[model samples]
Target: MSDRSGIFAGEDPFAIAQGWLSEAEKIEINDPNAIALASVDADGLPNVRMVLLKEIEAQSAPSGGAFVFYTNYGSAKGVEIEQAGKAAFVMHWKSLRRQIRVRGLTSREEGPQADAYYTSRSLKSRLGAWASDQSQPLASRTALMAEVAKVTATHGPNPKRPPFWGGIRITPLEIEFWADGAFRLHDRFRWRRPDPNSAWEILRLNP
Candidate 1:
């Protein structure tokens, strides 16, 4: 007999994830798409930060399925991901008392999809992306505003996505869904595979 039911009913982990996220967006106070992205540097030190998840591609996607987020290709996380070829992230919703964790191989998403997402941002955000030298030291806030102004002037009203800025997609080999339970217990289900192309082997973890 299986315990998985209700919210954990789906066979496709990606679809289940999308369902959870859609529910979270209605209750989460802010940034429902926020994920704590984790990566490692060349020295093997761990790095983690909050990033807004841009998309959750379905299993039918060209790359099978992925979690997508964008950043400056020259940024610290970006550089580390390129060096390590892997990353992990967890998206938790306090309101729903649930979380989804993923570990996976990464690749750049620098195509037309990136362009369309860049175009969807507000003008100021788009310009800020062009202006900011992410992960680099800036002298001061004033200097940053000045740079923003410079880019605003140079790039005009409709600037293109910077060559150094785009998306990164993580195709997970492991995905875990967890929800709180009573009396300090928790429910956890993990779907893992040897590779992205392999069938997931599901397991229930003690929590």
Candidate 2:
């Protein structure tokens, strides 16, 4: 792994991903933590959208590690992911000329971690979570605002996290690190495994 200009010089893909993200945070103009999340619907149609990555858990015994983010459980992506029980995402930083892609199994994190993250958000956002019927048809902007106002009043200042809002964790089965190079000859190293419990098989791929 170290041969690829030392960028992928790590046994742990989670650690490498964390390192690349840290570098991106220093130089990327905005939303350095953002990832393009992908999921598939019941009919096997694909969907992708941008979301801020909330955490990158290091590799451990049981959980092994995961990428985490929050969203409304009833949203299109959430429903899609639940249907497929799998997801993928890509983190691309133009400033660093690097990208990391991950494909994995999905699971819910609706316990204390989800609650804590929800509490850390702004009051308006917490209320908004309770107000909007995400990915569903809305009558008008006025109607949406009115719903928000109603929820604000009902939930008050320190509202609890909505039952339908929580974290989604993606435990990667394959992770690929890619960096741009001279003459478009990029470097790539992929860590693949059948499941989280299995050992990784690393490969250097032609770019």
Best by TM-score: 1
Across 35-102, the per-residue lDDT of candidate 2 in tens digits comes to 99999888888899999999999896356889999999999999999888999999999999999999
Kindly list the per-residue Cα lDDT of model 1 for residues 131-179, writing each as its tens digit: 9999999999999999999999999999999999999999999999999
Kindly report which residue stretches of model 2 are placed more than 4 angstroms away from their true locations once superposed: 1-5
Q: After best superposition, candidate 2 residue 39: deviation in angstroms? A: 0.9
For candidate 1, report its TM-score. Answer: 0.98
Candidate 1 residue-wise lDDT at 27: 92
Per-candidate TM equals 0.98, 0.97
